[model samples]
Target: MNPIDTDPPPPTACFTYGSLMCEDIMAAVCGAHAAYRPATLQGHRRHAVVGVAYPGMVPNADHRVQGVLYLELPDSAWPRLDAFEGEEYERRIVTVETDGGAHAQAWTYVFRPRFAHRLAPADWDFDHFLRVGKARFMADYVGFDTLQPR
Candidate 1:
């Protein structure tokens, strides 16, 4: 007879490009703090979603998205993250390069193609997000209040 292994598998890294890139927002959504590293995803573009403060990521062969790579997020956090992303985004596995030039596999939320029309023509500016949009996003975004426990 053999004993069963019931422990959950190790957590994987998550690549966050928009509001989740903010440590404060990540902590609020995850219900705990996570370690992260500066990373960039190739062949993707980040654009401001229509009438929204946060940005959305889409595939673009010529572009790249700079974001944070959150390390080893617990399994419990995915439901909250998926719910927060809503119907417009889908989580997918992607390769990212850290600032230290190391490559890693990470799960990233991508803006659905059907919602492409909602993306503004211009690129989403992270600096502007940090400077101006963070406050409004934190205050008025309803997703935070509606996360259901898994």
Candidate 2:
């Protein structure tokens, strides 16, 4: 008889500043996702990644990036998200400021050191992403390969 295994607990939150800020995109990446709240990560700046539609975050002492804080993420979603993020981004802990004056600790992806060369100097714009880049991303960004068995 095979022994049964229990799944890991779901993630309570993650702060997203890139394409994942889009609910539709999140659903596609993580299948039936989580709740999100308006959030701003202080001391970081969002920059456009050259040749790609999404953005990457880098530390900046005086800058802040606005995004969303996702809540109740499913455990199954992390593998897919981690895969989609690839080695270019590293998951890290950070505190975010919200409209209601609340500060919350959440996980977010940041650009890896070697990949920093790919980040554009100008800050990435979220509203502009929805308007100009999202369509192309949903249609063409490379995803799913990481989920494949080795």
Candidate 3:
């Protein structure tokens, strides 16, 4: 008889669109660099969250959001990322397209339905974030430690 093969599923890939797309943020969160590639998530619109600098994605058949696809993250890393995201967003499986015409499945954060009131009507601009908001976000952000269940 063939040997039984039993193992938990491997760690997952993550797709990041806003502040988490910054190497500085991910490195700080996970305590190391995570590999990533440029990819686009279709059929969703990313909007600015009310009273905050971060962005949130909502389903829109005609829209698309471009971001980095971080590959094969250790399951150990998800908690910190989750804490950093807080309850405002939920991780969901999404299909992304790379420039080479390849498609992939990765986990991306989406705005929680209960938190829908936080989304702004206008689309979020990553350029504006890189130009102005990114610095403030880096300086003032508290780590996931504070957010861990107490």
Candidate 4:
């Protein structure tokens, strides 16, 4: 399915597979009350790489990618995530399946073609990422003070 759709009316949920999976990262962008559920998407693969805290998604030759489904956040959070990821990533719509078999629509970041070839394994050590990377990303995110910066 081609998941990309125009912004949904206020109160929309997004699926995050990278740094956003970290609670601190979510809090930095979506606020402390933001909620999320474990979900998985098909036909994509998550890779691990060195030098990055989050995993990278590659077009799966034979598998699906697993990720978390975040609860809808205020429209204000969009720019936060956008700035956190920068221009190399494009927000795309994707359908994620919950363990209970319900389907939900959400946004996910995908690498642009220009960087696709350059993306290596994400080196995604979940334990390390959750414990370390999450905090670091949030510190950097919140440290900025403003998305546009002065």
Give the TM-score of each candidate: 0.89, 0.85, 0.87, 0.76
Candidate order by TM-score, decreasing, is 1, 3, 2, 4
Whole-model lDDT per candidate: 0.89, 0.82, 0.82, 0.69
lDDT of 3: 0.82
What's each prediction's clash count?
0, 0, 0, 7
| Residue 118 miss distance in model 2 (angstroms) | 0.5
- On the 0 to 100 scale, the lDDT of residue 140 in model 2 is 86
Q: Candidate 4 vs. truth: CA RMSD? A: 5.1
Q: Put down candidate 2 lDDT per residue, 1-150, tens digits, no spaces.
A: 334576544345789999989887787777766878899989998999998899999999999998989887877777777888889989887888876789977778999989998998888888888898888887786554335321
Model 3 Cα lDDT, one tens digit per residue, 15-75: 8999888877777775557788899999999999887778999888999999988887776
TM-score of model 1 vs. true structure:
0.89
Better of 1 and 4 by lDDT: 1
Q: Top model by lDDT, which number? A: 1
Worst 10 residues of 3 by lDDT: 141-150
Q: What is the C-alpha lDDT profile of model 1 across 73-108, one tens digit per residue?
A: 888788888888889999998999999999998899
Off by over 4 Å in 2: 1-11, 142-150
